[model samples]
Target: MSRNILRHWFSVLVATLAALAISSNAFANTKNYTVTAPDGVALSVQESGNPLGQPVVLIHGLLGSRLNWDAQVGSAELQRYRIITYDLRGHGLSGKPTEAEAYRDGRRWADDLAAVIEASHASRPVLVGWSLGGAVISNYLAAYGDSQIAAAVYVDGVIELKGDQIVAHSEVYRDMISSDLKTHLDGERTFLSLCFHTQPDRPTIERLLANAAMASWDMQSAVQSMTVAASEGLSKIRVPVLLLYGEHDALVNTSGAIARAKQLDPQIQIKLYANSGHAPFMEESERFNRDLAAFIETAVIH
Candidate 1:
């Protein structure tokens, strides 16, 4: 991240707080495109930054879309990275088929990602996935070849889930998604309070919640598929996997992920932000961008 952008963010943070009292709105613009998933569903791909730069495909979490990645997408430093993001089916502006077959245990979502990669025409591009997006990339690599990906970045979204744990945590994930979008928005407001005790300005926080609230979905399908992925064969993965997460993120513990990464692929790299939660990209944007740039620099982009 450039020092200028850092200073601008701080200024924006202060201005957002002051303006929050008058008019509560400060979201950067996000553009959308449609990509056909393998299942024939039109998934929505949202994006920002330079489109002609080194391609960087971004994936969001469960019940999330490109909007969740607003801060990074809107950052000035992104000029060098063509940051692409999208709404998985059933979330945000993507095509949502209620049929159980659409979600179909999760293959459809991963396939959608594949189509997006091909559509972008990004040869050996870097993939940045968050939470559910992490699993999607994992499944993508497992089912097909990832020689097209120069590197894969998993942001706070790798852990194992299975059997009873699925039912046990369904409500947890569902309730968060099932709540009145309004109340959920409010909750995120409070969540930012904690996630950014250091200094979460109103605009940054509002934009975050707004983008998040737009990510409504029927996650039951992800629940089912991810449960299966909890045990999916990932030991064969040879591509560079860089996992960046938080120390206090309740959804997935860092120690467990670090241990799992080592067990799965001794070649993997891991970084845990001391003051981050589920949304490290937003909470610790500087560190996140720094690590990401370093990783990209190391990647042998073809």
Candidate 2:
């Protein structure tokens, strides 16, 4: 070909490449970082979506990592909100302190969450907690109060662990605190199964089991032993609260918990996933995302 013809083709190719680069950057927008807790433990954090949008920090359940919120993080419905998800200490890529005392005291949980919020540069962001994460956020309220967050969404979580409520609600709680590894692992599997009304696929089950095995058993037991009752904090919260639970949740008393939460905070809104179990976020993601957006718009941003 002539020099002129070759140059024209090269220019077109360069323009195409530039467009592809811009598209790739837009598609891969998530950023990962680490936040060091007050106890000197580093927590892995992931932030995605529009940086200037409203922030929503998500905390995972027991043995669950930031990966649990992958659906929400990547959903187009939530693209307008800055989504932040982190691995709790002793789970996933976060630091694991072998000492039982680390988990026994609830300060670390609150501090870790606070560090994440500060790292995200988010003020009064909505905090979404799943399962044990409910306890973690409750602990945060107990320590830091509700000034830092605009609202809270509890996804089949434990808001009250006082008295015999937890023990009576689920046998898995007892197994989690048990000393026998076999019993604990068995309980973990059972708990995972109960999280969904239908059983998860083989790969998902294996992945969940692997994540559960990565947790420090001692730390799990230690945290489970600690008493976390958020009744007072819930009553005192100035921001609106949203509670989401599955109708067939075997691990927690969904109806009872919602009733108790409503009694404690009249501003609380509760939603039940008719076809789901413990993990309504994953099992019924579309509805969950829609409800979440509605809640944020009406109860929080507006």
Which one is best on lDDT?
2
- Tens digits of per-residue lDDT for model 1 on 88-145? 8777788877676666465666688889988877767788888777777777776665
User: What TM-score against the true fold does each predicted structure earn?
Assistant: 0.76, 0.86
lDDT of 2 by residue, 4-66 (tens): 999999999998786555435434987888999999998999888778888899999988898
Shift in Å, residue 211, candidate 2: 1.2
* Residue 121 Cα positional deviation in candidate 2, in Å, after optimal superposition: 0.8
For residue 5, give model 2's deviation from the true position in Å.
41
Model 1, residue 263: C-alpha shift (Å)? 1.3
